[model samples]
Target: MKARASSQSKATLLAQHVRAGKVYRREDLAPYSTSVDRELRQLVDQGALHKLAQGLYYKPKKNVFGEVPPDENELLAAFLKDKNFLSFNPSVYNSLRLGTTQLYNKTVVYNHKRHGEFVLERRRYEFRMKPRFPRPHQVTPEYLLVDMLNNLDDLAEDRGSILAAAQRKLASFDRQKLQKSLEQYGSAATKRLMKRWQTAEQQGSAA
Candidate 1:
């Protein structure tokens, strides 16, 4: 009289939606939300899911890290899933090996609008989500770069390390990528960063 633990059809759908390197949302796992949420909560209660935020979760690391503490980046990334724009941005200052200061908190930004802050484990993510247009890529790389660059100073303590990231971004990024991105997320600042990146590229190439 009880529902089976794992329905063949439902399991297939979950595997289908899960792709390597991509964070998933409830919709992605909705096929089994009824069955899975319960089982999932069981995992969390068992300290398997390691709750990241409300309605967001991820698998534990393969290698043991003693207590299996909450992974802020994973939990934060998962929380930002289904967002208009989200990316992993690590600037020089935050790069511990780069000799810059570190934060007591793990910080992140949500470029798309979703007002208010939410608590995540030991970290408090203070973010302001701004309304944004759709982008071809869920989160364009260039946009991520600029956000890192603009916030580099606040996020990183060492100017040297920040400069290194800036140069690496300048050298590797294709500024024109922003033009195509405008088809999706057209913003004044995105446009501005694109144009600036282009000019710098031109000068760099000429030299």
Candidate 2:
């Protein structure tokens, strides 16, 4: 009875910390008690949480439509156990007015851990271990430009037109931030492209 009561008490405390539509891991609940494993299993059986992967779990948030999976931020946080990741739907490029209308079916996650593609809760997430990304969780226009160039070879769009569009929009971006991003995260080829672009823009400005 005492052991059961203690387990229940710890579970209650842990439950208070579990937010709906959020992903968690056993390590995340370690501060509450040492019996987190047992209590987490109990919670899973009780339908309070759903197991995602080996150590990953989610608190399902249901609406009239049915259950919704946690967003990429929540899922990746639990998977990597660190928030050091950048995620974006590659399809976002189509909406960026980047002269590409083709839709992609993958959510790319750039992180220090994991490589290749994974399907979580019916959503495709592709993980690539990157040394640097300009920001976490969201894509900025400047970074998008860098990324588009970095993955240019794999893109289905017309490279010439895209480059022309990027050239036209160069002044619309934050020059310093874009330069810093290029210094940190840009590949050799990407940097070369930027250098040429910057030089051309300088000459154009002078003219």
Winning model by TM-score? 2
lDDT of 2 at 64: 93
Tens digit per residue, CA lDDT, model 2, 92-206: 7766586977788888888998998877767788889998775653457777778888888777889899889888888888988788778877999999999999999899889
lDDT of each: 0.53, 0.83
Model number with the top lDDT: 2
* Tens digit of per-residue lDDT, candidate 1, span 1-207: 134445544444444544433334555566655577665555556554455566666545443445444454555556765435442334433442334445445344555545465666665566667565334355556555544444545554666665565554565655576456543455565456556756887888899
Per model, state how many residue pairs clash.
2, 0
Candidate 1, lDDT over the whole model:
0.53
Worst 10 residues of 1 by lDDT: 87-96
In model 1, which runs have C-alpha deviations exceeding 4 angstroms? Answer: 1-24, 67-77, 82-108, 131-207
